[model samples]
Target: MSFFAGIKAKWNAKMDKVLKIGDFDKQLTEIIADGVVTNNELETIKRLIQEYGLTEKDLNIVGVKAFRAAFKAMMSDNIITQQEESDLLAIKDILCVQNELVTKEMAVLLEHQELRNIQNGILPVIETGGILLQRDEQVHFLLDCSLREERVVRRSYQGGSQGVSVRVAKGVSFRVGQHKGRMVSERDVVVVDTGNLAVTNKRIMFLGSQKSFDVIYKQLIGYQVYSNGLDVHTSTGKTRQIIFDNKQFKADVLQLILDRVTIQ
Candidate 1:
């Protein structure tokens, strides 16, 4: 009906023909059947891509479905082991050779799996909090305000009336009694100066006092390390700089981010 849709349908038809001739679909099924894409399998895939003159779009059309099947096979046990993660990464890397878009799709799948790991409490996390602000799940803290602070405010008020006597025109006198009232109020305010940062299998999340942020591994474009903190750059043209009390944690965090990014 639409121009792009028509093109896509034509492309899919062409790819279907190519796939059948090369038996690419069957080969892909065999490769991922064991939840691992062996070297021989990878070589065969590369050969098929070359022999069929398959473009990145063609690979994407085929690879995504095949990757999903492989992932499901890997997750059939309801748990993803370190070995399984490694195997998935290997398969994703070979797919990346076909197109950059493949990298993004793989990252999303991996991130979803990693998110599941975090939800299951199987992923390790670093808990620290002095969080002043949060955007989404991304937490922000001031380096100088790494320590928590609390303050209390108190207020008091009192009112009183003295007794009085009044005489009316009819020579009647009336006396009024006085009363007093007092009130006090107190409120406690708390400020957070640290937050927990977790690098799960798929994304980086900062849990802060006021807010939190989640930056998926795919969205992270780059990072700059500083003596006191690090600045994370994302594909959305935003940078988040975080300060940690312990400088060593910066290295650990950077490594974790790189590990997640490199796999895809």
Candidate 2:
């Protein structure tokens, strides 16, 4: 018999022998140190719990610790495989863990998976509620973003006199040949709309409250990645950008743009 099996046999043979809760927790900690909780280990834990008269509630602390260890182990490489995800979900089912964390982590993991799928050419045309997609196009990232673009506004300083003039009399002034009044055509960055910024296999699309655009990969001249957003340039003489203020999928979006989109 194996070591744990032999220990179980001996403990079973001794009728008066009992296992302590702390000892059980320590054993569980050791088992989860490798970031994997095997089926046999789980079974052994269940049997030990029954044999020692310990409730699942009593093991809550150790269970959460084990789950966290497994989660960290999966995240150490920055990618959560299907098996690792399965392991975490299993642990969550067995333990009373925080639901919010699992939900958020699962979402991020799904996004990671979608990005991978895009790279592998196994894309899916998912149904998005806020925007419409063309046939055979797949969206890898769709997020709420604020659209900002350069606009020409003939700006003029109005609080004070900005006209070039010459003093002719005590209280009256003679204006110069042509007083432009400080008005000039200058481009200013302004938030024009709120919308969904979507990166797809074929194009980058923006469906906004006040505007919408679709720029195909062939039209892309260049792109820029920021700490919180992305900007794409097209060859159509018009440039626009959107700010999402989120860092979660920035890398994935950048990778997608770099991979399929042709930069001129």
Candidate 3:
């Protein structure tokens, strides 16, 4: 068996034992590592077959250079984000433990991205191209070339009391109304029996300062204000309100949202 095949064989056996013991977190971590290994191995196999005209015999010759070149291409094309690169490098560390050819220095270099280390470094160019995966105090970024900030505006229809929602991206939709869009504004209000309404915490926190706004709005639920020529209040600490004023930005966000929301 090849190195990966051998690893899989052992992994499967270990999985059986772990399942019996029910070490879920450990098992999940192993599964994620295995998935990365499988994906990389499949990619390597595809390249070898299409370009080098090699067979199974060449698996032993697979080196870090091939992986590095493929990864570099993906980065240039914006296929994978920096966090993904870090995950792949972590997988490589595990792989290196099994193979003597994979070196420590190379793994470190692969894991590190100077551009990602500094905030606002890559934002100006690809602001709407990524997702910030929150983990503890650190942020893990992932890019979705299919969606952009200008194309993810949140919209609330004129006559709806069902709260606001974001427009969906083309070819990407989850449920009936779970489309990913930008936050515009939110407010808190009290409904009385005499057809009177009291509005509070009206606030607008654009996409750029979303995290900070979310933090502050969670505590300012009683204040009210105007947003996009409409009156509203920041009533809920759970949901975010977003709006886009720029014509082109609104147009793009609406088109992408409609593309995802239209009934098939």
Q: Pick the candidate with the highest lDDT.
A: 2
Could you arrange the candidates by lDDT from highest to lowest?
2, 1, 3
Clash tally, candidates in order: 13, 0, 23
Measured against the true structure, the TM-scores of the candidates, in listed sequence, are 0.36, 0.64, 0.19
lDDT tens string, model 2, 115-188? 66656665545567766667776676677888998888566654444457898889998776653344457788
Superposed Cα deviation of residue 47, candidate 2 (Å): 4.9
Candidate 1 TM-score to native: 0.36
Q: Which candidate leads the pack in TM-score?
A: 2
- Summarize candidate 3's per-residue lDDT along 1-264 as a digit string, tens digits: 899999999999767644533332233234453224355654544443445333333333333433444345445544355655655565444322233455643444433443333222321112222333233222222111110112333445343233455458976544443344454544443221111111112222222322223232233443222222122234553433333233222222222222222211
| C-alpha RMSD for every candidate | 15.2, 8.4, 24.6
Q: Is candidate 1 or candidate 2 better by TM-score?
A: 2
In order, the Cα lDDT scores of the candidates are 0.61, 0.71, 0.35
